[model samples]
Target chain A: MDVRRRNNVVVTGPEDGPVLVLAHGFGCDQNMWRLVLPALARRHRVVLFDYVGSGRSEPTAWSEERYSSLAGYAQDVVDVCEELDLRDVAFVGHSVSAMVGVLAAQAAPERFGALVMVAPSPCYIDSDGYRGGFSAEDIDELLASLESNYLGWSAAMAPVIMGNPDRPELGEELTGSFCATDPEMARIFARTTFLSDSRGDLDGVSVPTLVLECAHDAIAPREVGAYVHDRIPGSVLVTLEATGHCPQLSAPQATAAAILRFLEHPR
Target chain B: MCRTEEDPEPREPDGAKDGDRTTDAAFSALLEDSVEELYESAPCGYLSTLMDGTIAKINSTLLEWLGTDRETVVARKRFADLLTVGGRLYHETHFAPLLRMQGRITGVALEMRTGDGGRLPVLVSSVVKHSGDGEPLLIRTTVFDASARRSYEQELLRRQREAEEARRQAEEARRQAEADRARLTEALAALQRSLLPAELPVVPGLETAVHYHTASPDRLGGDFYDLFPLDGKRWAFFLGDVSGKGPRAAAVTSLTRYTLRTAALHDADPAGALGTLNTVLHERYTGDDPRYCTAIFGVLEPDRDTGEVTVRLASGGHPPALVTRADGTAHFLPTPGGLLVGVLPDPHFVTATTVLAPGDTLLLYTDGLTEARTGPDRTDLYGDEALHAFATRLAGPPPGGLVQALTALLDSLGDGVDDDTALLALGVPARPGAM
Candidate 1:
């Protein structure tokens, strides 16, 4: 497996600068970091890649068994880091990718320098005492919506789904402006991402970490964010003024500033 | 303007003036009251949110459905805050991002948390309103009750799951039926084997070998053969086939086998033994379920002085025997006109006498050998001519070798051999020190 081809790796900035790897969440690909890239790319060597089943990555790399859990996604991240031979890397993850990055860092702690989890939740379902924001029933409804909406997306994305390399026009039709994704891939990825329980993985993190929680985030509520911060030892928790789930897109300046502040101050 | 002069002013009628006054008052009432009435009590809920999902304005009807007043919902709670915990997660992840990217989204299903803590299933549509300078201003949203649609969707999901479960169970049943049939076939196979001799009685001077081939795995075949000693000097051997297959044919096969052995005890002649078997079968099955058999019974008498075997074989509608001589030559010992045994009480049974000296072999078999199918489609038969041709090539092999070679040929025929077959070979070993 060619890691760069599978993840659609894009590397920029000074090669000598400290590496910054950005992993996007479930909905979109690396395009989610477009707003923050401009501000952060100047000072550090920025690295970005799409998960195997998402965005411009090789579509054929998806295997139902391998991708049934988030471990497969973390393996892809580790592959990219290993392929580039980057060490002590600063990793930024948004949404579900935050847990994905955590797993990757845990597998290879020497390669990861620090972790910045943006609006991350270790789990999405509510347990005995934990308030992870959503219920198991809610997740089912979300899966139902995915299936219902996929009827249209599948028709339009059939060509791309078959991985036809000869017809560039059909591929263009699939990867049009927004977060264009294969419907089946999106559905499976959505299930894998939300249904995962990584609360047990938080304590094993050895890297310096920052948990960036936004005000009134629906996907990861204030309590969920705080829960993640409390679980990880010696980790800093920063509450941003930015609202909603995606501050990277909505308030990129504030998001980037918080990240830069964390990077500048080692302690 | 100066000519505004009032020359020729007409007088107004009292009835017309009253009508004009009534129409003017009705138009004024429509303009004044309907606007507020339509905004407050419309069928669907209406609300406007700023870019951050904050609820800026909400109508009375929406407020009433949410069971909350305008002030509590207005600036204090965001539109997303009015949603249930699950709905908020969905709104934040998919709904809001889609609205931001597409500028408008329609028919999005979500549940709003009412003030009474009950959930309201609603279908929402929102459009991002823009300022005149093309800057993003506010998001205007409309909500409709989707309670009925929700219940219908739930019912559909339940039915789909039930259908999948039914299909899974049906597949399991089919597999079970196949397993049961296999077990029954195995039992029938064991029963069929019980009708034949487990081991041949050793003749002092003759080498004997036999093979039985069953065409199907799941049903009992009709072919059976046995070799047993008649006395100290003579041996009785018979190879026969009943008419059909399965349990009924199996019954007839067992009856014929025992009748042959008993008849041979009383008479040393092959023809006399077959006569007894024919009468037994003809008497037992005289009704609608008539059963019949084709058989060849032979008596082998070894001469100790000459080192030769005298074989008298009586054929009853069976294929002729093949004799391979000492000089490596083969020919059919034709018993031309013998009628099938068990079909009639007095069937013609013919005896073909042959001598098996040193290096001579006599092979007896049922018609299953010659009448076996030759091709995959079974369109061609391994007729008497083909068997004759194949036997001539096997002139040098002894009894055991002949049986083994023919079994290999049967295996190569694959699906072509659709009937059960039984073979019995008797070879006289070459005289010691003859070379």
Candidate 2:
């Protein structure tokens, strides 16, 4: 399998520079990193990729059995790393992909060095005095949300949105196309991301990790970030002065600066 | 009201100026009242949220629909707060991202939670308001009540689901019907095999072969043939077709086959065995649906000193037996005026005797062969003359080879031969020294 084509792997920046693999989470694809790509690429060889079922990745490569769990997504990460034959690389993952990075680093420890988690929650459902910021019913509600928005993500509307007649160049842009994935694949990814519990896996982290969270995020609260920080042996936590789950798009400079600072000085 | 003066160009039109001033005053009052009323009481709801989705301004119509006061909604609740949990998730995941990327999104369906805890389905369109320097400022959104349209869409979806389920059930039923037909055909074929001999017994100094062809698998064939030993020296062989097809005729054929074998073992005379069969069938079936059949029962007696088999066969309403000579000539031995068995109280069967000399073969068959249609129009019958000619051309081979060639001829007839056919051949081998 050509992992590069299967995952839609995009490589930018200097060849000899340190590698930073950026993985997007459940909703959008690698295009989510567009706002922060320039600043990080100046000093690092940044690698961006869409998971098998999302973005511009090959749709034929997606299978419900493989992508219904985070391990299947971790295989995609491991495949990209092995395809490029990179070593001691920094992996930056957003939202649900942060736990995916955990699984990949454990599966192939030699390929990954440091971990960067952006606004991630190991478990979205709150349980056993642990506040993951949602209930089991809420996750089901999110699935229902995906069902209600079926028309929004339909393939019929994709061409109309991508082919904006007033600005023909925008038709070629990847902005509107990033979030238009196959709805069935998106539903599986949603169920997998919201139902996953990776807090126990954090204790096995042997690499330097950065936990980046939004100061006022509705998805991942501050307590979840502190809990992740406390679980890892020597992990560092930084709160970006941003809102929402995506700090890369909401506050790109702070997100990029904090990442660059962590890359230059790990300790 | 102003009226035109009859005296043209004389009056200063004082009355007209006074009337115009009064009308202008009333129109100004009406415009002032409509400006705010249109914004507050429009048919659709409208709102404008700040960049982070804080409701900065809302019209009175939207507030009324949400069942909330201006103080509670304006600058207090975000746009997502008014929507149901599912709708909020849709807003954050798909609607917001698309709106941020494209600057505008339209006709998105969502459900808002009213103050009374009821749901109001609505379609929303939003556009971002940009500053002069192209910096992001706030969002302007319009909401329209879509209760009627939502119910109609629900109906369409329900109908679509019903259609899919019906199609799936139809496919399942068709598969079940096919499986039932296959099982029935298999059972019928098994039953049909039970009526025929598993294998022909090997007779001393005699080479024998037989073939049975069935027109349809769904219906059991009425044709049957068997060859078995009668005593230490002589052997009995019979080939016949019942009066009709299917299980009823098959029952009669089964009776006919067993009665002849039993009667032959009792009395080895060819005419005597057929007489017993005719009596048994006539006694068993004597009603409105009287069962009858056409048959040929023969006994083969071989001479140990010379390669000669003496054949004595009796035909009852059956075609005449064919004898292919060693001299490459074939002729039918006529058994004239043989009455159909089980038709009369004492149906007389005609007996024919022939000597199977070296390199000579005797063939017995049912009428399916002679009655088969031939020619381009399929209106002509392949009569006894045609079979005689065909048998003459295929005279050199032994009984097995002759049966094989005749089976191929039957296959070439294809759909022209619609009835089931049975063929049995008995031949004596030529002496090795003789030409």
Q: Who wins the DockQ comparison?
A: 2
Question: Using Cα atoms with residue i matched to residue i, what is each candidate's TM-score against the true structure?
Answer: 0.69, 0.80
- Give residue B229's lDDT in candidate 1 (0 to 100): 90
Point out where model 2 deviates above 4 Å: A152-160, A163-176, A196-206, A265-267, B1-41, B175-212, B217-220, B226-238, B246-305, B310-318, B333-354, B374-380, B389-414, B429-435
Give the CA lDDT, 0 to 100, for residue A88 in model 2: 94
Error of 1 at B340 (Å): 10
Q: Model 2, range B1-435, lDDT digits (tens) per residue?
A: 111122212223334455587766665565564445666776778788887788998889899998999999888888988988767766766677666666667778888999999989888877777776666688888888988977876676578669999999999999999999999889887878778988888887888899888775566788888898877788888888888888888889889888988999999887788889889999999988899888888888888887788999898888899888877888998999998888888878899999898888888888778888887655798898889888888755678888999889888888778888989988887668654
Instruction: Show what share of the native A-B interface contacts model 1 retains.
Output: 0.20
How would you encode candidate 1's per-residue C-alpha lDDT over A128-200 as one tens digit per residue?
Answer: 9999877888888777665544434444333223443322222443345346577678878989988999999
lDDT of 2 by residue, A56-161 (tens): 8999999999998999999999999999998998999998999999999999999999999998788888999899988888778778657555644454346547
Candidate 2 chain A, which ten residues in sequence have the lowest lDDT sum? Answer: A162-171
Q: What is the lDDT of residue B15 in candidate 2?
A: 43
Off by over 4 Å in 1: A1-17, A43-45, A52-68, A83-85, A125-130, A134-197, B1-44, B115-118, B130-135, B148-220, B224-238, B247-353, B357-363, B368-435
A56 Cα displacement, candidate 1 (Å): 5.8
Clash pairs detected, candidate 2: none
**What TM value does chain B of candidate 1 have?**
0.64
In terms of lDDT, the poorest run of 10 residues in model 1 chain A is: A161-170
